[model samples]
Target: MGRIGVVTFPGSLDDRDAARAVRLAGGEPVRLWHGDDDLAGVDAVVLPGGFSYGDYLRAGAISRFAPLMGSVIDGARAGLPVLGICNGFQILCEAHLLAGAMVKNTDLTFLCRDQRLRVENTNTAWTCAFSPGAEITVPLKNQDGQFIADEATLDELEAEGRVVFRYLGNPNGSRHDIAGITNARGNVVGLMPHPEHAVEDGFGPGTDGLGLFTSALSGLLETA
Candidate 1:
């Protein structure tokens, strides 16, 4: 089975849920420490959400330099699968594995809602289980979930079909309604929603988030 590593930062709120989701999707969940420098041979990595370092300099500014993140950066660039949720997404950008930065919500307040999103692209390892154009509901909660990019990066991302998911209701005021995005090669994905929190049937936003884990696993198998 694929070994999926879930990193836990000091204030990480969703690492357990992310591990459970990986187990439910039939993958091994390996717990990784933010201070540790190794990934323990995991096939994929997931950076779970929370106010890492209490969101000091920026949401992800501090966590971006965690010891394990260096290995993650190398692995992701080598085409290993990686997924970032909420604050994790912020970290990916801070780490430069993904483009752009997250800003405060357009309303200038933390927002929480059962957000609807469209899977605009399913070619990424993290979203391959979902169908293109599929509509799914997941919970969104954060103070700085807005995504912004320079015009040129935005155009390049659009032209390359790297925009993987878009919000249906335009929550958080993300450009092009983008809720999630993938790297050019589709091995790394970062998004502003909490898919791990929505994986369980009654405990979450329903099982809508399971597809993310499952889809990623399936995509890996299909290619191998």
Candidate 2:
């Protein structure tokens, strides 16, 4: 089984959930610390949700500089598959691993709900198990969940098919209804929804999120 690393930042609340999701998907979950410089030879990595660095100066501004992020950024550049959720999404943007920035909801209030999302791009490593245009419901809870980017960048993303997920109801006032996106190489992805929370049946929204972890495992197997 692939050894997927689930990174835990000081304020991270979903790392264990991510690990459990990986395990459910038949991958070995490896715990990775935010302060560590090594990736522990894991095949893939996950940055789970939470108020990293207490959302201090910015939602993910501080956590971007965490020692582990340096390695994460480097690995992502080299084609490592990385999935960042919620606060993790902010960190990826702050680290420049993915485009766009996450700001407070347009309502300027925290939101917690089961969100409907369209799978726009199934070509990404983390989304391959999903069919294009599939709509999945997952839990989304965050204060800074609004995704914003300049028009040109947004157009570029649309043109390149980098927009991986779109909100069905246009929740959180995210620009273009974007709920998730992938890097140019499609190896790195970031999204506001907590896939980890939706991985198990009888819990969360449903088992819709398990496809993400399974997709990653499939990708790793293909490369192996």
Candidate 3:
């Protein structure tokens, strides 16, 4: 089975859920610490959600420079699969692994709800099980959820089909309704939704989020 690494940073709220999701998806779960310098040879890495570092200096700004981020940066640049959820997404952005930035919710309040999302791209390493334009329900909880980029970058992302997910109701005021996106090579993906919370049968929003892990496994197998 593929070994998946889930990083745990100070204040991370979803590391356990992410690991459980990986195990449920048939992957070996490897716990990784933020201060560690290595990835423990995990096949993929997941940056789970929550207010890392207590959201100081912006949601992801501090965690982006965590000790372990160096290895993650190297692995992602070498095309290893990486998925970041919510606060993790912010770290990816802060680390410059992906483009754009996130800000306060348009409503200026913490938003939590069962959100509808359309899978816009399923060819990425983390989303191959979803069909293009497929709709799925997942939980969204965050104080800062808006995704923003300059016009040129936005155009590039749109033109290249890098936008992987779109919100159905524009809940957090993301640009072009984008809820998630993949890097240029599709190996790195970041999203605001809590796929980890939706991975099990009885807990969370239901197993609607299982496809993310399955998709990663499929993509990895295909390339292997």
Candidate 4:
């Protein structure tokens, strides 16, 4: 089984859930620390949601410079799969591993609910198990959950089919309803929804979120 690492920033709140999700998906879960530079030889890494640094300099702004992120950025660029959920998505953007930025919601209120999302692209490492056009429900929560980018960037993302997930109801006023996106290599991905929060049935929306972890394992096997 593949070993997946879940990084824990000081204020991270969902690292354990992400690790458990990885384990449930039949992969070994490795815990990584923000202050460490080593990746612990994990096949993939997950940046789970939380208010890192208490959202002081923006949701993910400060956490972007954590010691571990340097290795993460380099690893991701070298074809290591990286999945960022909610605040983790924000940090990816802040680190320039992913494009765009996340800002306050349109309503200026923290949102918490089960959200419906459509899989727009399934070629990504984190989304390969999902069929294109498949609709899945996952829990989403955050104050700065709105995804924004320049028009050219948005157009490029659309043109390249990098927009991996789209909101069914356009919840946070993100451009083109983008809930998730993949890098050009299709290895690194970031999304505003909290997939880790919905991995177990009867505890979350459903098992829709499990596909993300399962997909990672499948991708590793295919590449191996």
The better-scoring model by TM-score among 2 and 3 is 2
Could you give candidate 1's per-residue lDDT for residues 155-194 as a string of tens digits? Answer: 9889999998899889788988888898888899998988
RMSD (Cα, Å) for all candidates, in order, is 1.1, 0.6, 0.9, 0.7
For all predicted structures, in order, the TM-scores are: 0.97, 0.99, 0.98, 0.98
Per-model lDDT: 0.90, 0.95, 0.93, 0.93
Q: What would the per-residue lDDT of candidate 3 be over residues 1-224, giving only the tens digit for each residue?
A: 78889999999999999999998898888999999999998889999999999999899999999999999999999999999999999999999999999999998999999999999998899888888889999999999899999999999999999999999999988999999999999999999999888888888778889899988877777777
Q: Which stretches of candidate 1 lie above 4 Å from their native place?
A: none
Q: Report the CA-based lDDT of candidate 1 relative to the real structure.
A: 0.90
Error of 4 at 31 (Å): 0.4
Q: What ranking emerges by lDDT with the best candidate at the front?
A: 2, 4, 3, 1
C-alpha positional error of residue 153 in candidate 4 after TM-score superposition, expressed in Å? 0.5
Clashes of each: 1, 0, 0, 0
Question: Which parts of model 2 are misplaced by more than 4 Å?
Answer: none
- Tens digit of per-residue lDDT, candidate 2, span 110-207: 89999999999999999999998999999999988999999999999999999999999987999899999999999999999988999888998899
- Please give the distance, in angstroms, between residue 5's alpha carbon in candidate 3 and its true position after superposition: 0.2
Error of 2 at 91 (Å): 0.3
Find the 10 residues in a row with the least total lDDT in model 3: 215-224
